[model samples]
Target chain A: MNPRKNGILCLLLVLMCGVLVLSGCGGGGAATPPATPPAGGSDEPAAGEPINVGLNLELTGSSAEFGLSGQNGMKLAFDKVNAEGGVLDGRMFNYIPADNKSEAGEATSATTRLVGENVVAILGPMTTAAVLGSIQLVTDNNIVLITPSGTNARLTVNEDGTLNPWIFRACFIDPFQGEVAANFAMDVLGAETAAIAYDIVGDYSGGLAASFKQTFEAAGKTVVREEQFSAGDTDFRPIIENIKTAGPDVIFVPAYYTDDGRFVLQARDAEVTVPILGGDGWGSGDMVGIAGAENMNNTFYVDFVYMDDPSLQDFVSEYQAAYNRAPDGFSVLGYESAMMLVEAVKNAGGTDPEALRSALENLGEFTGISGTMTFDPETHNPAKTAVILESVDGVKEFKQIVEPK
Target chain B: MRWTKYLIWLAAAGAFYALTLALSGAGFISRFMLMTMVQICIYIIMALGLNLITGFTGQLSIGHAGFMSIGAYAAGFLASTYGGRVSAALTEALGGAGGAAVYYIFILATLAAGAFVAAAFGVLLGLPTLRLRGDYLAIATIGFGEIVRIVLLNTKALGASSGLPVKNSVGWTTAYWLMLLSVVLIYNFVNSSHGRACISIRENEIAAETMGINTTKYKVMAFALGAGLAGLAGGIYANHMYLIHPNSFNFLKSFEILVMVVLGGLGSITGCILGAVVMTVMNNALSAFPEMRMIVISVLLVVMMIFRPNGLMGTTELRLPFRRKAAGGKEDVTHGL
Candidate 1:
């Protein structure tokens, strides 16, 4: 062997060892070991072992903001519960959070790791795509999974309307939300016709648009026009002009904040002045800045809960102080999911998977920060009211809560 | 001597298989790690295929993932439609003995179907665009990838954007063996006379053509073969993951495979394998630290490129220590022993 080549190989070997050691130390330093159960007081039963709850979230990719906010909310809720003498007769709730990187393969790997940690239940991977990717593992393991904001109708139920046994969600399904928005459009706004502009490439927007079209047309109102644009599309004048010519009473834009805000601004610029409604995808704070406050006036959207609700003032203040930002829909839903899981653990009398699952299935009207949520045994979907909020000068003001009948 | 070499290879492979099985059974290797191992194997097959096309044939393909997606969707669809029936029939025919055997056979059939469909697509894509070279060929390939993704996203029969799920799970053991076979086959092809002709074209296309070598036929053949192997990897991946989505095979995936090939030393088969293993492990390891994963990966890539611009192996192959020398007796110093 050449001495120089051997020297280079040795250098590479040392470098590789250095990297392994650094990564090992970094992982140890970052992941704080789960805390032991606290010493019990007279009223509390002897503190049992902590219950492990897994969180698979998109903490670093395109949807990192949503996952980060949810993580904060879950942390706040867990802290509050532990501080007030933890659940299941003073058993602490230990969180095992894994970042899925907002990719399908990563989601499965994250879920697999979480399951390997022996979690009693799992929460989140936020988006529908991430949930679909890993739901098989969760089901195969028979671990209870409560997603905070995966609203695709298929997540909870199969195409044939059979339940996915181990799956449950805190947010309303897309079809239900779409139906509520459509009802509000026809019955409340007295609109005779509706127009929809949605991103063709995204499942959320496309699904919502399809549902809204079905419901609105079912209500005997004409779907005047349906225009499609892909994500990252800038110009909406051509679509807005087509909608304007159709002259619908309202326009539904079921897209995320970035594209939704742009569409609103462009539609207003083109002088097509009809109320632009959307789904929860318009809940981000950046929406106001993207479409100026004035331009966003009179716009409405459906959400899990209205941020300005008087009932949630205490939670709102605590969350704002803790995170230095108001909790969005994802945050509140995350808090609700943790609260629901803890409550089920308490009701089940232990952290046994089967017991906790039964408790969740039989859970009745539990008052959450979002709303009174009750999981339907058949669909595992929470039967809760949807909130309608009107954006007034960039501020989301509470309008009405439409109940599911 | 040749028989001895073959025996040694078989023994080594068997030992590796036994070791992995023991580790997995004893719970020394976690499921996550096993999944990562399967992912590395899949990437190895993909990088090897891409290396044959881009590194040896001198045709840059930015759309290898398209063929992979085709293979995955085709295999997933077949598994969904026929997997259960085939399993039941085999079980009934062979009774208790066929329980696991049926599954292995079904997986093999699914993989073959995936490869065949993908190779057909390769021929379809290559016949038109193989005439173009360089950036034009790259652009055409990119278009092919996007077209596959968009078409799958809109096709209801293929489950649209939601993706199709294969009910029968292919364990890591089966996937590992299949991937190993693919790598061996690709290695053998790259060392054959056809491979030499492909390399000649890469060296100087006009010279090879003027020498009466059919550059067009070899180029198409190499492209189709690479694509077929990639399809086989994709089928294995789909079943191993139990899910196949259009987004999984987007341009980023192709870029990742290309990175492995380039970073491994493009023309070296052993380099592709080493590159795939290192990149996959690094990716899985860094994922533990979500905030700094991409940053660390980028910095490492930059450092690697700065140190060895031609890649880690730089066209050198790794060979068994006891392998015989070439006929000229000059000693093959290109092997990184």
Candidate 2:
């Protein structure tokens, strides 16, 4: 250890100081201007009155795509509202976005920063686990937290069925998708037995699969075979072989589109053809590219709304016109949630936390591009129409819309 | 000479604590800043623990996060199940819950509980796995970390993947003091006779063994001490975030901590501290630059490794303020007993 090299290292220390100082500017502010700069006379401009809605999305981690989509949707909603002369006496809904990095702890920290910003409500954290991790902080802060697409059944409801006041979601819970899929398979597809091959590593898939199985079995139909595969698994031969052996009337592969490609390809390769069912996570065009249109035939999944649905054309075009891309379930939900928040703020007449929460709870019926949503004030879950879109030669076609009983 | 140096270190640390307290008191520091500062302290303690084994003792225990997970769960269980009861009881003795005394007692108790549990497991793990060296040791530690993660993931009591959420009685003051205390204890141990035995083994195990040093015993001791420190860090972490997920302490986490030790210069306390602070702050700060964050971090790490293979501080410590005079070919006051 030459002491002379210490001199160079000390210079590096000074260099590190520069890094720290630069980065400090980025993360420096406590809460991005705490609660509207006091409204201190001097003719506050329109920008000064913008409502700070916190967006705690998974912008740069494993679930970056979904978070980005959600962000885009919210941004569109904000932009549209702002362009139309803003909300609540020309107050633009200014959003402060925080990337949670798709980690739970980061989500909590991000939520804290958002709360400190004194946002009337937080729009998202995209995924279920991130939402769960962030929930406590928002609850403690008494800010309404409306996730765009967090569908885990237990998110808003505890095991004992107690409801968390601050948490709400624009998307229907997992049970709705499971029930919709079960009823669709049982009543429409006329299946006596179903096979489920779910992504074991994902938080959404397992719970969704469980609910589907529960609803299917409770309706006096058996889940013939249940196979597990992790998210990154490429081979579906072993599981597909087992599913083929079981020979259930329908096969449920409840997973993200990322996992859908390999499984669908391999299952088709094995020539084990049955209607493959999934949840909203399967609503992506990548499925066609990977598994081929022929392989994706007879496949259906439950989603909030199909992009090709005539009623959704306005939203689809708006999203495409705004971002140059078609809208997915995440973006749709993000758009709906942001719009709903704007409505709530309008209904409450101000951003008073309690008033806003009550307005959100009693939002009753919200008709957005996604569909008509009637929020259950008790559970904070939405009762909305779940659409089953069938893949016909790599293109999704309208199958049927299942109304919540 | 050493006594005066340590006292100076203490004074410097005290001043730092006071300065931060004043800053936050004057509302100069944001809650987010305070949170980041606390996180740096926790990571520093963790890095120091890893530094003891992998750096000083030359044992590559990559699964340092395993001990941390164990410690966190243990602390989480205590705080969630009995935190209120204990706090209330202690509050009855020391006036009320409004005071800081009860919180200190409660947090220290949880930290100690976590440390003992992790240390006991460390002794259990090190007894058999210490025989393996280098990569083999790393592999074994990785397995241990994975196993702990899986166990926690499946445990219904801990909320599995969703994670166990608990309110914490800890704040910046508790975190800062705990870190300073850990660094001082480690410094004292490093300058002690047992520390030399461990260092001797690290330098040359065969020679140290031939010189009547109980190499295995010293190695195991270093491991337990290191693990205990990791547990302490974990306990603070759980309190800091108010949630503990097994996935957060996975294999990648172990690799990150190892990167800190190596990037900080293995076997150098100040190096580990520097590494820990830089790594943690960099992670948070990089988030501010969304798009270029990871790219910048990766490029910087590559550049650092290419130019400064020995790391920022290398084997030499940054002598703060009053420098100690080197004399008699030795820096430590302890003369082999």
For residues A143-212, write the lDDT of model 2, one tens digit per residue: 9999988888778898789999899989888877888898899999999999999976646888889889
| Native contacts kept, each candidate | 0.33, 0.25
The B-chain TM-score of model 1 reads 0.94
lDDT per residue (tens digit) for residues A1-405 in model 1: 764484358347635944784478346534644332345634323456677888999898778988988888888899999999897667888887889887776788888877766678998979888888787898888799988999999998988988888888888888888888999999888899999999977578988998899999997889999999987788889999999999999999999999989999999998877888999988855998999999999799998888778888888999999989878888898999899898898898876668888898888788898678777888888888899999899888988899977
Measured with DockQ on alpha carbons, how good is candidate 2?
Answer: 0.44
Poorly placed runs, candidate 2 (over 4 Å):
A1-33, A36-48, A199-203, A228-238, A289-292, B1-4, B84-104, B326-329, B333-337
**Model 1: how far residue A27 lies from native, Å:** 8.9
lDDT of 1 by residue, B191-297 (tens): 67888789889999999999999988999999999999889888888887767888888898898888888787778887788778878887776665777778876
The all-Cα superposition gives candidate 1 an RMSD in Å to the true structure of: 3.8
Candidate 1, which CAPRI tier? acceptable
- Report the C-alpha lDDT of model 2 over B156-242, residue by residue, as the tens digit: 777877788878567899899999999988888988898888888888999999999998899999999999999999999887787
